[model samples]
Target: MFFTEMWERFSFYGLRPLLTLFMVAAVTQGGWGWDRSEVGAIVGIYASCVYLASLPGGWIADKLLGLRRAVLYGGALISLGHLTIGISGLVEHKLPFFLGLIFIVLGTGLLKPNISAMVGDLYPEGGARQDAGFSIFYMGINIGALIGQFITGFLGEKIGWHWGFSAAGIAMFLGLIQFWLMSPKTLANIGSEPSRHPDPAIQAKQQAQVKLFTGIGLALLALVVILVATGVLTINAPIVGTYLAYALIAIAFAYFAYLFIFGGLSTDEKKRVVVIAVLFIFAAIFWSAFEQTPTALNLFAYDFTDRMVGGFEIPATWFQIINSAFIILLAPVIAGFWTFLGRRNVNLSSPVKFAIGLGFAALSFLIMIFAANVVIGGGGIRVSPMWLITFYFFITLGELFISPVGLSSMTTLSPKRFVGQIMGIWFIASALGNLIGGLVAGNVDPEKLELMPKLFTTTTLFLGGAAVLLVILAVPIARMMKERKGADQPIDPTQEVPDLPKE
Candidate 1:
């Protein structure tokens, strides 16, 4: 499972590192010749849609075909999406480009939730082994991320963008193949079947529910395809068309959530839903700043930063590796720190973790501000490359605290039935974040170089402040959760579930 996930992530991040460049490149340079705004819109929309799809992805897994099928389908979609990118690279067909992106979005939606769920499924309940497995899995994710950045960044910038994208697609294919080949029933089980001791009538009802969700996933994918109609809506459609697609998806999300939140869930489940929504919103803010690496930050590395190293010019995309690299290096230290705190019985609660994440995010901006202040050169000015690396060090710490922990928290706190759906909402926050990041990136000054720090700082400060606010709010949220779930731990150890909540 770890190796399969690694290769999949390698493909995902590999393509991600080059996306903005691909969008900005000219037809001759193997790019789409898109303007900054268009690039922002496309990237923003594409990334956001990918994250948003998770809700549906979650539903398909938890309620529909179970974990196995969800991962398979999602993996297949991701593979196709990569293939679409490769096709676009060769043909430069505008509609194909959009089609490819749509595939990628839906593919991610399908794959992400199920795969992660499977990871947790490997362990029973709150055993320390579960924590260790997550740590290991996350390390694999970052390792894949680091390699993807290095390979894609170097190849896209120095070789060809198509090559990088093609490589990513190929990696996805390989991961898909491996997962298909290796089905470990017990190796790292994400979880067991939701319920098996049911009476025949109850079993039938469960099967019916699962079939309904499975149909919904298929229908949703089909609906998007129809709207896109590879035959009709080329990339030339009005921006409203894209907006409408998103709106429809949002409505679907609301509709499904309405069922689960109202009739399908307990009061505790609804509280967890609200908490997940808040966490997702905050996560959006984090991604808006951090996700910039691919788009806004990638451009910054290329256009603003001085890439000279002993008179050598580093490709702009190489800078993309910094965050992943930092993650690989920092995860253990952070995990150990968490363990140490846990031993002391200190609260490492979700809201507090998120708050620290926000604060750490703010501190990273301060680092950037200093880096910007000291930059050399007259026009845009260049800082020591170390500054970017330094900034990533802090930001990655913020990530370690928030991303994985938040994911675990969602699975932990959710009702077993709604785990996948809640995870989907979490990804939706990511989609919103990417969209928000693109919007923030849209404000980049093409003319002035010095303003880069200021732009980033403006955003970072907000994240930092939000983190503080969340930390303050965490006390209450955690308290609420504690009161509700004082002795009601997960009933099914295999479910990988967590708390009741008011957060």
Candidate 2:
């Protein structure tokens, strides 16, 4: 599972640094030379969709495909997606490139949440051990990312963009092959089947509903695609992205409402769900800032940062590896810190950790504010690479606080039956963040260098305020998260309703 995730991330991060760069590059340089705003909007939408798909992907795992099968199918699609992108470079067509992104989004949706759920399944008695395990798993993710960004970034910049994309595809294929060979032996019964009702008649009805909705959804998607392909539909990507930000908020609210009003969850479960919802908002804020590394910051490296090392110019894409490198180095220390605290019964609650994460993310942008001012003061002269390195280091620290810890909390807190879906919900926070980050990246115009400091300042203030707010709320939120004596026991459907404490 670790290797699979590692390779998957390799494919993702490898291509990520290239997306905006390729679109904004000149035709002579094997790029389309699209406007920055258009590229940012498109990339933002694409990145968000990659995570947004997780909701349905998790549902499919819980209902139709089972986690293992979903992962298998997803890996295949991802490999194909990368290959399609590679082919696009050779053919020099827009259609294949767009199609490739769609394929990857779909594949990631299916694989991301389900795979994480399976990891949770590995340690049913979830606790500090699970947190440590996830940290180790996270190391796999960064290792792949670090190597992928180094190699793919070099290939894309020095060779051809498509070649880097092709390398990513090949890596995913290798991961898929190894997973196919080893999963049966190593995983055994884990994620082997879908969770289904025991009543055959009800199960059949549920299956039929799944098929019906799936067919309708696919047909609608095909219609939209066909219309767009034929030029019957015109898209203002930035405008659409602005609307999507609102839509994401609405969707999250509706989903949580449905869970509270209709889902058969106990009072304790409801409280944890509320806590998740609070964390969800804060997590979205954190991601919106952090995800800019591939867009706003990537552009910064290309345009404003000095990359000359001993007179050999570094690839701008190489800077993408800094975060992953930090993660690989620091994950063990953070994991051990959590375990040490856990052993002493002094570990920080998830909410408190979230606050700290937000604080560090704010600090990262604070550094960026200074860097942007340097550019303004230097009359657009390139600044040292230390600016970005310092920013990534702080943000990586923030990520360690939120990401693995949050994953552990989701698995441990959710009702057993909804683990996969809850995991999907967690990724939704990322989806929201990516969407906003992309939009923010759109405002980064090299022609208007003065806007850079303003942009960084706005981000810093927003993040700092959120951090303070979360800090203020952390104690009450942690109290809400405290489990009752029998909270870990299997919930019995036949049990009577019990009056619970108010929120």
Candidate 3:
């Protein structure tokens, strides 16, 4: 599971540093020369769809293909997707690029959740060993991220973007081969079969709904393709993207409402679900601020930060490594600190941790505000690279606080029957965050340099305001959580199932 996810993340992170840069670069430089707004819309839609697909992916694993087969099929599709992306270099056409992204989004939806599920299956009776396994797995993910960002980012910028993409493809294929060879022995019988409720009537109704929804989805896809072909619409057109973004937020709200009002949950369960919904909103806010690393922050590194050290100028993509490096170094420290605090009987509920996360995230942007000020104060002069490093350090700490805690809360708070659904909601919230974050990134202007400081300041306030709101509601949320759980419950020894391979 660890190695499989490591390589998957290697491919995913490998793409992150290059996507916007490739899109917005000039055609003369082997890019499509898209505008920042267009790039943002495209990236946001792509990212959002990747997470949204997880809902169906979980269903497929439970009702149809099973985890082992889903992982295998998903891995194959991912490899093929990267191959198509690499082919975009040869053809210089957008078709391959777009198709490649679609394949990857679908593949990831199938692979990501199932692999983590497999990790849980590794220890049927969970204990400290389960937590330790996940720690090892999480470490593998960061290691892959560091390598991907360092190697792929360098290759994409210094060599050719396609070469970097192809490297990621190769790495994924290698991981796939490793998994296939070893799984028969190591993961035998685990996640090998589907797990569905044994009720013919329920199964029949589910199948019907799946068919209906799938048909509608296909019809919508056809309509969009037709519109694009006829020049009636373009992918990621600003006005269209704005509507889509609003639609996503509405969908999130409506889904939660449906669950709350009509899902027939117990009173206590509904309260817990409400808590999940609140955390979902906060999670979206946190991700919106954190996920800027590869988009807005990457651009900042390229266009604003001074990278020269003595004589050699550092690669802008190399700056992407800082967050991953910090995660790798600091994750264990944070975990140990949490355990230390736990032993001391210091209660840090998820909401409080989330608030802390938001605060730290705001602090990161505040650091950027300082960096932006330095540039403006120096009359549009670039600032030191140390500014970006410090920014990453703060955000990584913020991530440590919020991301893991939120995942744990999702599992603990959810009724067992709806745990998968709640997990899907968590991913969707991240999708929403990435979409909004991309919109924020789209507002960044290289021409109007003075906006940099203002932009960072605005982000600072937004995230800080969210932190304040979470803090204000922390007591109530904690009370809700404690109502369902025992006051002196045994410590849960299992680590969180990761949302993505990254954290």
Query: How does each model score on TM-score?
Result: 0.85, 0.95, 0.92
> Model 3 over residues 71-138: C-alpha lDDT tens digits?
88889989999999989889877777877888888888888777766776686554455556667777
Residue 332, candidate 3: Cα error in Å is 1.8
lDDT by residue for model 2 (221-291), tens: 78888888899998998999999989888888998999988998888788878877887888888889888
Q: Pick by lDDT: which candidate is best?
A: 2
Per-residue error at 248 for model 1, in Å?
Answer: 10
Q: Candidate 1: where are CA atoms >4 Å away?
A: 184-264, 267-271, 370-377, 448-454, 489-503
Question: Native-vs-model 1 lDDT?
Answer: 0.69
| Best-to-worst lDDT order | 2, 3, 1
Clashing pairs in 3: none
RMSD of each: 4.7, 4.9, 2.8
Candidates, ranked, TM-score: 2, 3, 1
For residues 1-503, write the lDDT of model 1, one tens digit per residue.
67767877888778764777787777787677777656766677777777778777776566555777777777888888888877876775665666777787777887887777777667756456666677677777777777877887787878888788878877878888888777764444443243342487777786687687667876876776677665554454226435744673475468447845574677676666666666766776787777766777677676667798787789877886788777766766776676677578665667777788888877877887666556524556665677777777788878877787677767666676666666677676667666655554544445655566677778777897888788788767766666566356433221221211000
**Ten consecutive residues with minimal summed lDDT in candidate 3?**
492-501
